[model samples]
Target chain A: MPQRIVSQRIVSLVAGLLFGVGLILSGMTDPAKVLAFLDVAGRWDPTLALVMASAIPVAAVGFALARRRGAPLLGGSLRIPTRRDIDARLIGGSLLFGVGWGLAGLCPGPALVTAAFGIAPALVFTVAMLAGMFTFNLLFEAGSRPRGVAKGSGTSC
Target chain B: MELAAFLPALAGGALIGLSAALLVLATGRVAGISGITGSLLGPPDDDTGWRLAFLTGLLLAPLAVVALTGRIPPVTIAAPTGLLALAGFLVGLGTRIGSGCTSGHGVCGIARLSPRSLVATGLFMASAAATVYVIRHVIGA
Candidate 1:
């Protein structure tokens, strides 16, 4: 592998490590803590909001600093999303995601982190999530191939 | 207000931000967990190396903490099995269709000031709040 690939992997590894630690430290790995926050009719805890509120500004500063450069330090173009259009897909999908999030108090990042700790619910969740993704690809992309279209070449964000 | 909980939450949130910043600065990839994981499931492409590495780091995080502190933090889940499965499925499908999740749209997107991300984040938060209300008050789950 090239030296750039090595550096990119290292950077991604370290960044992911820090992100997981942050998730643990913020109590996001605990589904009960998340559920507690979501239970507005019960004991409502606002700690998770505090997590987002704090993380966002710091990320904003980081984004501003990174944009000053032409490319990333590891020598690749940035993969930032450029879409500004909002449609039913965006709203509908977000609503579905939120409902699921509220139902289980686990999303992708936290669920994966929790599963690493050998949590059974999270483990099951991770498997089911992967299955769901595969189902989406099959239903939406796989069978709809045109005459000259290639496999796995459909549009996705 | 528990000062003990407040401090750690703030510190951890800051650490998450730092990580997000570092990824964007160093590799120019949005630290969106769902998108990264979704791509991993699709094909055995050359990009698998980094995604695996990043996930390995996530798995190792608690171990690293345990090594440092000599104890793992406590975690609890109150939802039943069926709900967990259904919710996980919806999250998977929704994130794939929506093209982002909390970390992607909520944190990184908002940080970059993307309008679509802003809208997605708002809608999700509202829907989550509503779900909680209905489940707790109406359904009493």
Candidate 2:
């Protein structure tokens, strides 16, 4: 079990390192670049699309392989989300995320990733993201679970 | 096909997927960022050490890269800080309401082929696209 814990930490670290490096290399860490792509009327930059398109296949294949195994390398069975119906929350969140992405061109991942670059704005985004997460928790108490129950519960369908 | 640009995302995504798999293999935990972040705020004795370390590494990894690379690219925002903060707040609220973020739904959840994750991911992507359209063209922000 200890071995597994260490391995999980290592994997998480590696994943984060790669993600940060990818953000830097793909220029996703740069809000100006992302905004430029969204600037369809002016100097439209399609760079972000290429990154997304490439990432889609990689993500798809990874998920496919992991699914086939029925378990992850570290240890636990993959806990897939079971809810299917869309609601106002989903719509609202997506719209809000997009607006933030459009306005700042810094989503959560890249915003966190780019903080290493020492960008003032990335710091702002990261702080706001954390604040947002905290605020959500306070208002809805979303993840509050019974003391001994598992994190996801697997009960809600 | 801009090999330089494509290679990075491909490598990065693959690494992220692999890391998620590794974490699951090693610790039996979902690589859900929201869940990890949430744990930070709860009871201190709830085994949050690893989660804190993981998040810390996430923030520091880029810094390490910048140190080695000499200089990192600059970040620019099209909107004010207040607007960005509001947007972040909304995203957090959405994640709580929806039960997960992109990492949970889009990456790990979808990989498991859960119907709920599929719906959530679809909603997230669609909303994101629509928001972009409105902001850039409709609202002109």
Best candidate, lDDT = 1
Clashing pairs in 1: none
The regions of model 2 sitting more than 4 angstroms off are A36-44, A56-72, A85-88, A142-144, A147-150, A153-157, B1-5, B44-47, B139-141
Tens digit per residue, CA lDDT, model 2, A61-105: 565665677777667466434456666765565556555566666
What tens-digit string does per-residue lDDT give for candidate 1 at A76-154?
Answer: 7766666778878888888998998888888888888888888888898888887877776766655465512231222
Question: Evaluated against the true chain A, what TM-score does chain A of model 2 have?
Answer: 0.86
lDDT of 1 by residue, B1-141 (tens): 878979878888888898899988888777888777876776555566877888888878988878888977877877788888998999888886777788888888888888878988898777877888888888987
Candidate 1 differs from the real structure by a C-alpha RMSD in angstroms, to one decimal, of: 3.1
Write candidate 2's Cα lDDT for B1-141 as tens digits: 467755665565555566555555444455666656654654553346567766777777677776887775666666677877776666655655566665666676666666666676677656655666677788876
